[model samples]
Target: MATMSSICAPMISVLPRRPMIVAAFQQYCSRRTFRRTLQVRSCSSATSHVAPLRRLANYHPNIWTDEHVQSLTSTSKVQREEERERINVLKEQTRNLIREKQQVAEQLQLIDHLQQLGVAYHFKDEIADVLSRLHASLDHVRWELKDDLHATALLFRLLRAKGFSVSQDLFETFRDEKGNFEARCENPIRGLLSLYEASYYEKEGESVLKEAMDFATEQLKALMEEGSVPEAGGLREQVAHALQIPLNWRLERVHHRWFIEACSGDNTIDPLLLEFAKHDFNLVQDMYKSELKELSKWWSELGLSEKLPFFRDRLFENYLWAVGFTYEPDNWRCRLNETKAICFITLIDDIYDVYGTLDELQIFTDVVNRWDLTAMDKLPEYMRLCFFALFNFVHDEGYRVMKEKGLDIVPDLKRTWGDLWTADFEEAKWFHHDQTPKLEEYLENAWVSISGPTILVNAYCMGKDLTGEALKSFPSYYQITRFSSRLFRLIDDMGTSTDELERGDVAKCIQCYMHEKGVSEEVARSEIRELIKKHWRALNASLSWDSPFQEYFKNIVVNVPRTAYFFYQDGDGYGKPDGETKSQIISIVFEPIQI
Candidate 1:
């Protein structure tokens, strides 16, 4: 007990400052009362030590030092005020950034409105003046100031729409410091050009469009070599280059007759075959010339003469598709005339039986059956050696492939010749005029009746295991037809034969399905996007197919999968209506595997 009293003596004993100390203790107790409400573990831990003190002191509240409390309160107020000022500064900065963005958005909306007005009222002199001013203002904007390349490209397009050629000027002005401008604009100008070129080259000769292609290619290469540009933009260069050159150009350049003519030696005329060659060349040339005349007529019929330049390319593409295989029965004269002496009659039957007029068909058939290769001089201006060369190529190649497969081909050839002649002669009564179908209807029929199914089948054969039932059921003739059809169809679709829709006509099957499901275009488009992505995923997930045919399929499917943005028009023309948003619907067709 004595030892315990000694231990407590320091804590309890009175001293000179005993009253002051006691007052301090009472004040500390009052502070503890307020702090105890906090429920801190430390407060609970200290409660045990304070129990005896409460019993002993029973102290009254004592005033705290004015100096200490005033100093602490003033210091806290200063700190809080400083914090508030800091918050206000941050908020002001955010507000400024938002204002900047909104201003930019407003500017974009204004630009779009101005463009719509320009296109709608282009012919009106007053509106033209307004459009001109807008163009001047927009043209004055430095390319480096554009935060988005897509936006800049669109602006350039708008300027072009306002009747100014911005292609060369756009490159000169906006070649540097684009920042995210490239990201935003997406190089829409180049894209438009590429699509246009790709669509155009399908029908027209490459040489005819080479100048324009070179210009576009140069612009694309500049974007790529700029190095500072994003890889995304740079990646488009190859596509631009590819679109510039159609497969026909590559094929024909290396092996086709047009290329052979261009590269022919010394322009030396072969006396024996010169007239024949010139005659055949003229026939082929005349055919193309006739196609161009037909195109002009088609344009006039549609009242699309003003839009002709826009479709001038696609029209040429249609020509390419039409004429690609049309005159294959004859080609440019070759040096080895003897080796090229095979008869030309592969496509004559198809033209007479399927595509030609009765009178024209009769003329063709009679020429085929009765005409003599030895009597080249007696033939018309169109039936000379050039035609002979092309004919020889078809017959010779056909004979070789057939003979290698162990078939008696001579009698088959003679029978085909007779069939062509018979059809051509008999159809003369029906050859009143060339049949012309509605452009869209003709293309749709072509897709369903020939190209679409054929290409799809080709894609299947390239990927699927073609053993057992598939191998047996698929005939040699069907295989040949399907293969030739795909090649022709691809060429045709690529803008050579016909102008296939850019985004692909989903056919009623797809549109009806979407409508029946009661889904909005937005939802349907989303689903399509997901479906396409899923297809690509599955395609990538599979073992990489390495064969030549597989590679070909991959190229078509991955690189040039058909879409139909070109020929489709709603109530509004090609694009969206005023202040209305539109989404694209993409449907993918796949073959189901059988168990």
Candidate 2:
């Protein structure tokens, strides 16, 4: 039997050509006469006589303090019990409703509502049964929905979303002899909205869905411009919201409260279903508060905020990220461990990006790669503390997994940590040497540097059961990881590159593209947006691929980019959270829905 270490050694070697390219770039950079202008003071003892010049981001203090987070309380135990009982009853009623709905359209709408309200996990089996039946009888479904554009689009979206093999050819029924979506499909706002949302589920090379997207978008915008959409029932608001960010891309937990509020204004919504959604949301929110309180205590005790004051203290944001990845009450362990990993990633990211001199960063990277206590003495005091904090967290997690599942994942954890630091160190070298690689070269390293692999790998270790076979099959999963990380890096660059450049960081993907193509910044941004869409299509296609990973881990992979899109949609939401991010956090984490 192959050892886990031997089976997983290749996971750390993403983009093997990257090192040679980086070396050549460094060789070229070292020969440039202009290098002296870019060099900064080193933080080594040899330069102890000179005060080291450090770049400070001056990030705002955390809006949600540890004291406030620790002070949070949920409902009393008795009330929580009562609510749980009521929710169970509601679940039964919802189940019966699913069973009773003989019509395919009704079943699809019910499942869509349940998902939108963020309570679909309760009825996964029921929803799957319906989709399976509908998928099994595609001919009957096609006949039933032939004239009904709205139901057909809803069916296609829901079925495809569940990884069912639904064909885009089903949409041809609505097209005319010219192979264009008929004008009759335009006036029905409900059908148009459904088509628009469903179009986002398109895989690459699907020209029909692309046309449908363009048609629906044009009609929807035209109707809005003509003031034709009804102002009542929140339909207008729904259109605007979908236009801003489609349902397929938005984070589920973050969209839950908004959808619940939207349903309240919708007269067509069932009173019982709406009640169930509210209670479920509050109960889930209660669970999150408890988790946050405990995590807050953990963060407070970790004392990294005081020890490394230069980094952003973003415990609340990190918790939001964990919840975005996995919001089920049963998966609290995954959420907690994920938050801890992200906190350390953020702290270490700051060390490379903002504070650490190149020499100090290289030393820290070497220490992390060695994964040894003896190597810690070479790092600065601050780097030593950060290294130990990461070391203990990773080993502690590895210990838990080993004790529970008889799998020692310490080597896996250490490899991902080393990979992340190596990528970060490469970027630091780029910054210090004033070299701008092409966009492809930048992303080959930036994707890993973005910390998506590290976060996802930790998630896999803590959330999934490990076996020798699973470890053997792990290399295949890295493709999805790369896709997720690529999207994450691009979205992050779009949001933070301006500030990063001002603070003397390496050239991000956007800047790399502009330099490579000799295009304007506006053109570069537009191109990056196109790349985001392209990667999303690739990711959507990858979800249906057969792999050793269960849907639980796969969903986390997809949600990584979805969460990034949410935070960076407006502007550096995680780094500067005082704007819309603050209100969003309050709604999702703190404020309970009024039942």
Candidate 3:
């Protein structure tokens, strides 16, 4: 705890701040304001006293039709097997390419293309070998490759990603006599973008990298204004993309989709890697299609879409999110498990928030806490089905965990459900009473309500190779989960608060801060943004060897917060992803890139 505070505290002061286009959603939902958006289904505001619910469309029904789910396609069994064989062939071909001892820049650029095109995950050992060799030569390359921004920037990125202790001093060569970035006015976009992207990997106290961020960001923004210039259109596009989401913060799958499309016109990209990337992506997309179909079928069977009339039925968004968390085709089973669990969580969240009355909410919470069928009889009509659904899902999950990990997961599952409901009940209490707790008070419950801990704990249950010892070591109390959960809450509240406030609900960080400080919303948001960075800094610090969790689990935990950024960045993409989120879904799962 002391280490966490110390790590977060210093880094909170590390960097200064900088600054959604969800139009398709607005057009589809057709609500003038998102506050009244999902007024669908009978699952309107549950406060009871908030009479005459906001005049809006029925906010919740299965938006996708049977045809939609049926139409989602994967190649046939023989085709996928063939595809796998082709992938192995391409994998070896790419391996030979990475194995070749070409010029230093040539090899680095090949590695870069492999990574940017998203095929790099297939070449991890080879990539690691190359980077390890390069790192050993770093001191020598320092003097030789100094002032070569493009190569140096790529090296920093590759080394840092491979876990090498890269120095920020690699960028010092780009500074002028005044210790300012050289500004490469004649032509600096590529170097600037590379440096800008690398700056994101700097650890705390690296003020030089922070300055590079400022320099690169400013330059990128100015260049982005030039808009598709003949010489720099691609550069402008790349800069704009980097400026939007730093390389570290970028969601891995989404980055590949964007990078592949961006590279289409560039002649310098290696054709083999690009071609392999498209096939690999399409092959993966086939897996995603199969998984989504399974989830869609499970959702259809659960009958929550029909029984729980007003709850948000976001199956597509739920699976899309699960993809961000675990996208490798090898983990399709885990992805499906995660998708189903989150769908349950999302359904239960809405049931607690928008459907159940305050009295019904309390009873449902108690029933879930009890974790028994006998308790189901205590529930009201609407609550009965939800309680039954949740119990069945968790019991099945417990069985799965016991079968695989030899762990009695029921206790942990009960704990997560109990905690999630307690958090839900607290928010309902606050909303009904119109009380805005102190920001800290609100955030304490908000993080739990955001439900990262519960779902991640569930993830621990469903994940492979998690033994009881690892389970005890995890215990849902780790700093990584706590920090990322907090980030998820803060980000969610910032994006969804306006609508939530309109509907009359719990006070979020933004509202709590505004109420506590009597500040403007914009100012509160800016400060909240800074607090998010502090949390990410803490989250990052928690991932070192000092942490008890395994490295693979650590990587998964990191994506918890990144998932929030992706869905919430453009106006509740999870809730109404028809706009920008729609485009992302198409690129990630539906559409195949033409080689």
Candidate 4:
């Protein structure tokens, strides 16, 4: 295990020495006269006398400026050292508590808190050992939890979430002969909430869990309507939040502060545990600020926002999205590189959807497929700059891998970019032709167009546990990647399709479904929501299979969709960040937990 200092030290040493070409680009961007002239020239190619009529989305300017981001700083040295020492002490103490004997309910509750508090990564071995022991003593554990819906559901969820083969039939103990959950199970509210959350882990054909979900959902909503729950602590608030989005579906880091504050108010939790969680969260947040500062400088220096001003300038949101994928402290490199990939994805997505003419898009796609520097001459000035940035990013990553692991991943990286551009070009063709594709036809391309595979491929390369075997086995993870990408596309379409359609973009999944089925928009949206749920089940099921991918890589793959839900659950959170998205970014990235 690397210390936080060691994990962060590389950034300080490596970021300042950028390649000379990037510095020249930055110098060009710094010149206002040259930038304006280049922007005008790039909008209209030399081959055409007329400037193409571009469809601009008119995205909102980013609220987090480079000055603000760079101004963010960490705590004093004395305070940092104290917190580190205190965290180390609490970590060992927490491990001892996990090892201590307790009731099944108590032990499961502790594990749940550790996970929600975002400190469970420190005790994975201990948690696994405890779960293994509990799994082996099923008869006794069942006897103890047979009457306790909360414990039974928690055990079922935690087990299933960790890839244990626990049966959903365990929930059958709470149901009556009429196939309805008994009224007695509804009093505790916690039990109903637990059951509600646990049902989200259900795979296909699990009718019992589905029934449990529906019943618990109805009961919880009724309770909320009647205002019958006690408001003493955060239980009522937690119940309300869970009703909006189940715990299983949430990105933990996005909601970490809420959970931490909720736990702070709970009298049943240990003081030491709560204290440790606060310090740990703040410490990690400090690391995030450092990474953001470096990334802000890098993005500012790259000059994309200034050079190509039509696209969305969402560096802050991109970093937030990367954090959603993997928030552990040691994986800062993954977060940084993933943010870069997301930025390019956003940039290229806009080029194809909003700016590029059909002919230019075809040429761009062909150039990407060629994956050669010689092809750079065919693109417009703006596109040439974009391609050069992407080319540098891919090879830089490839060079790092080659230097570290003696593996050349440039071909794999280029292939992902090629697939993404190809998909984008297909969509551009559809929009250009005023074509509404069949739902199936649209989805076949929309998944790749969503950029999940590109992001996951880059994540696998930057992440630890990479191997020659894993590189060869990359194609075999298609089921996981496809499921995740399909979910991202469906969820994104559900949230952003209206805005996208109104702005003269291609028809998204919802519109395709409506056109194909001849249904109302409401019906189309509801059906798309069902599709999201279906793919989620498939994604969960894929994780349970024996795959050649490492568990870390699998988590990153699944988290792609999870992060999408975070951004798009309300509506185009990434595109329009003034609402909940802004608040979440302020809370998770900027604001530290009060100690």
- TM-score of every candidate relative to the true structure: 0.23, 0.92, 0.85, 0.90
lDDT of each: 0.31, 0.82, 0.71, 0.81
Ordering by TM-score: 2, 4, 3, 1
Model 2 alpha-carbon drift over 4 Å, by segment = 1-38, 43-51, 183-187, 464-468, 545-549
Query: 1-595, model 4: which lDDT tens digit per residue?
Result: 0111121111111112223233322332234243234435655653577776566789888888999998887898899999999999999999888878488988998998898888998987788888878888877898788888988888988888777788888877787788889534334798988899899988988898888889989999999999987776678988998999988778779777888887577765778788889999999989999999999999999999999998999988999889999999878889999999999999999999888877788898888889777988888899999999999999998998899989878888888888888788878776655566778778878888898888888888887668888888777777788888888889888889767765667778876666666666777789888988888888767766334247678777777878888989888999999889889888887888888
Residue 385 error for model 3, in Å? 1.7
Q: Comparing candidate 2 with candidate 4, which one achieves the higher TM-score?
A: 2
lDDT of 3: 0.71
Q: Is candidate 3 or candidate 4 better by lDDT?
A: 4
Tens-digit per-residue lDDT, 386-497, candidate 3: 7788788888878877777678978777787777777778776655444557788777777788888777777776666677777776644467788878988887887777
What would the TM-score be for candidate 1 when compared with the true structure?
A: 0.23
Tens-digit lDDT track of model 1 for 1-595: 0111121112111112222223323343344343334224333545665311111111111122223222321124464465446545543443343235333323433343222211111123433443355456654564443544434444443444333433333433333453111222444554434333332221123232233335555655565566533334323433444454432123221122322232233122222222223233333343334334444354334332132121111232223322322222222111011111111221232333233333334454455555456655544333343235444644664465344544333333333334334533332222222122222322223322333222333233322232333323333233233223333323332331111111111122122223334444345445544433333323222223434333333333322122211212122111221211111100000111110
Clashes of each: 43, 0, 6, 0
* Model 3 backbone overlap count: 6
Give stretches of model 1 more than 4 Å off.
1-360, 366-406, 409-434, 438-595
Instruction: Return model 4's CA RMSD, one decimal.
Output: 10.8
Which residue segments of model 4 deviate by more than 4 Å? 1-48, 183-187, 545-549
Candidate 2, residues 127-243: lDDT per residue as tens digits? 877888899999989998888888899999998887778888989999988988853333388889999999998889999999999999999999999999887778898898899
Best by TM-score: 2
Ranking by lDDT: 2, 4, 3, 1
